[model samples]
Target chain A: MAYTAEKPVPPPSSDELRARIPGWGADLDPADRPSFPRESLDLRPEGAHWDFPERQEPDGPRERSVEHKFLTPVFGTAQPLTGISGVIRRYAYDRFSEGRAAHWLLLIAGDRVDAIESHLKSFATFRPDNPITETGLMAEVKRHPIRSRFGRGRADLRHTWIDPILVAGPWVLTGWLVLKVLRPKR
Target chain B: MRAMTYRGPYKVRVEEKDMPKIEHPNDAIVRVDLASICGSDLHLYHGLMTDLRIGHTFGHEFIGTVHEVGPSVQNLKVGDRVMVPFNIYCGSCFFCARGLYSNCHNVNANATAVGGIYGYSHTTGGYDGGQAEFVRVPFADVGPTIIPEWMDPEDALMLTDAFSTGYFGAQIGDIHEGDTVVVFGAGPVGLAAARSSWLMGAGRVIVIDHLDYRLEKAREFAFAETYNFNEYDDIVVHMKKITGFLGADVAIEAVGAEADGNLLQHITAAKLKMQGGSPVALNWAIDSVRKGATVSVIGAYGPIFNAVKFGDAVNKGLTLRMNQAPVKRQWPRLFEHIKNGYIKPSDMITHRIPLEHIAEGYHMFSSKLDDCIKTVVVPNAS
Candidate 1:
């Protein structure tokens, strides 16, 4: 059989992709699926030729929905932890819940329903490729009328008991020490 | 330079190609002295693997002399003979630091499924394999080891993948002093695993396969009992009866995807690509091993879903320990075993052909012609 080297075709527009391919993750929205970078280089072995069509798109990011969380959420790039701090940051990101009104027990009935409605509304424009942006939507949910009953700002850090104060202690002490030391040396 | 390139399923050709150069600081270009066709390469040959673009090379088992070394390649120098492990790994990754080299975090841009493997396919980091005049070895210090003066180069070639992976299969079995170990498949990996089982203090080692010739080799080379599954009505039932119905102490699956048993399963899994390679051998392993026994899998399977008998395994309280063999970790002990004459991995080599004729070699091996067990390709042959 005759063989010929094939160049990869350009990726389709986002509309074309979403129309042709159905939703892949648990949430059936085109924006919830991870996207890949366009194919730019031809790395096929030299002198190798075949009539097969080049892949239209690179493989999608690994599935990382709630049910598939155990699987790696591979993106176009591998995410390396920057250091111990990165690990702590990832842990915080995974367990972030205080911004939602579910934590508050005394919200009025109408306020609780509004919080849920706001969260559902955010999914209307959710984009999977930019998953970090979903946090912004969640932030909107945190601002619902029901969350106001808890007397905390929408961006309040998720801390239990005096942990936030404890975290602030060192900086607070440093500030006080600086004031005392720099005060008019009378 | 002439290199073997894949055109399509069951199609490969040796064509003039540009020589590879250093693409990374840790890269070392090696003039391939010898390379072998592994059984797992058949997945690409049969078009089972995804993303195997045309013109891609298909090889992972190779040995060569260093032609050039990049600035950061610390342990290796020019002209040193080295045996590279199959997995391309960065030494400092979290997985590599824990000795899980096959799952190295760096190297492969798509490492969520597999770490870098030379020339297997684009899914395996897309690095061109050594089935040519040369191969680019990445992370040279961490993955490739210098060949000891006393070791045979062919032996060193086997150490790169097949032998090391086979020994790992036995190692993960956690064999006791007198454990009964059963190995599935009698291919190169299976044969190596069966042979290694004896060294692991296995009281009884049984190898199962449908091929009479391979089973015969298993008995002669591994010094173990062999069973041809075709002769028995139910292979697993026979294994259970032989092991006093309590099942063998441990079962090793050396046959990955493409295992043939249960015709319907073969259709859906192997032919249709509905599930991962037919879970024939793995299901047999689960059914044949004793409750709470260990099942060590070294066979190569796709990263996608497989219809494995996880519920059966869980109910039986079986421990399934599996990974792509961390090839470097087995080197020191394998070197000792080789020196002591406990295992001779090169004995399985049945044909040695030049790289130009590798397509024919692949065809013969894939077709099982002339009872071919292994075929080595020489890139520099006249």
Candidate 2:
């Protein structure tokens, strides 16, 4: 949500996070960190002539984390925030530090939302998503279906039974819904 | 000019961008001829990387024709077809002096771990990538080599990252002749690693993945035995049983960040982002290898807490070696291998997408749609 050049508001205090979340800052102790000895900030001389590199101007609003003082000098502009997914992603960046699991979980939820959005958008086009070819169902059938799964010491064999339902369940439901709608008032 | 720009997680588009100009004495402006989407780019696409700026181009593996060169550049001239290494390093830095171009000290100001990588994000030095009509290449004299006249441009593009990295993965394993090597992941880098393991005298090579198509590729391309980990109860135990309970002599982890295996680990790392990346492949590598065996990690992970099985590694007395591959350091041997018909790096490419359609290319690759193994972008294609 923050696209300003100014510094962002500070994140919640560590004390507050620790009070709210279980197992917060478990690795805060240097003794627990194996990499603590090598994590020294020696700040050796990096031979750049400029104090700050020239920033690539942002063409539109860019996402900024609450933990960061400001956006980096350069930022990407390929994809901008849109739909409900954008709002969720913005909330993740705004409320949680990168350390918090909530930040990432929310983002993952946003990705799922985005996928649904893409599926909806695909229907508007001439070619909607074809779950059959796209999902490699033909390849599964042609390429040693039973033989590969039966004797093979595959770890995913436990869940292979549900994969078809997981992959095709949505499409099947959607197709049935369409069929009902086109049933000519029967 | 036009380039691929990052919009947000799982979103990208082609947009008009400023033409790159030489900014340094050692810089060169390359008119991109071909750029490929790397498997590592999926980390950024999935929004797993930190400080990823919107609108930044996302490409690292590329080859192009030199359009302009800085005043100090001596090795290349305008119009020379060149293949640039992904690492943007100053040739004389402490690490670069030791041929550790990937860990060059002078390029990236954000962190001390990895050197500058084009289009990788500000963390790797905010250099624009070549998934565009033009890109500015820094340290031009040192990083970009003239593409061999006899080498196919497609082959040269593979040398930029995937092939070189795979070769480096095998090299660092310190593989003794006739050693059993198990590679986890069948991406281009994994395939290259499996193939290169033979060159290093590996007696038997095994490639593991859940995807049948990619596993098929591993067998056909790398000439190695392939297995689907999803079919096994415990892949690590299977490794033990197969190797006479001694386990593999060497294991290479090519799957990083969003590795899928353990549901809890995937949720914590990939979904919850509590850890930097899922350590499933890495844990499997460590557990599958024999005690005191060498494990090579070429997979990319964020600089944060990963739930890696370090205790197991220490207890087993395993030697773990990993780094960003020093692309140029392994080139001479790779060039010979390519010229000798021993390896064809271009064989991995499955799709040739135009720059304008790079967003679709990214989505397809990210989704694992169309059985895509590798995609190369043709900028300014007719």
How far off is each candidate at the interface, as Cα RMSD in Å?
28.5, 16.4
Please provide, for model 2 over B1-382, each residue's C-alpha lDDT reduced to its tens digit, 9 standing for 90 to 100.
9988765555677767878776667678999999999999988776677646556798999999999997767788999999999988776655665566787666664445557899987557667798999999887777899998999999999999999899788877767655788999999999998888777666668999987879999998888888888778899999887776778989999989978889778766765567779999999999999889999999888656799989999999999999888787667777877877778999999989888777667756665656779999999897
lDDT of 2 by residue, A73-178 (tens): 4333334567887788778767876667676566656755655676677579775654543332443443345664555444444433454564456558989999
Clashing pairs in 1: A31-A128
Candidate number achieving the greatest lDDT relative to the actual structure = 2
Runs in model 2 lying further than 4 Å from the true structure: A1-186
**Docking band of candidate 1:** incorrect
For residues A65-122, what per-residue lDDT tens digits would candidate 1 score against the true structure? Answer: 1212243211211122233323332333234322322211111122223223333343
What local lDDT does model 1 show for residue A47?
A: 16
**Whose TM-score is greatest here?**
2
lDDT, candidate 1, B81-170, per-residue tens: 999888887766556655577876555553355777888764565677889998888777677888999999999999999988888888
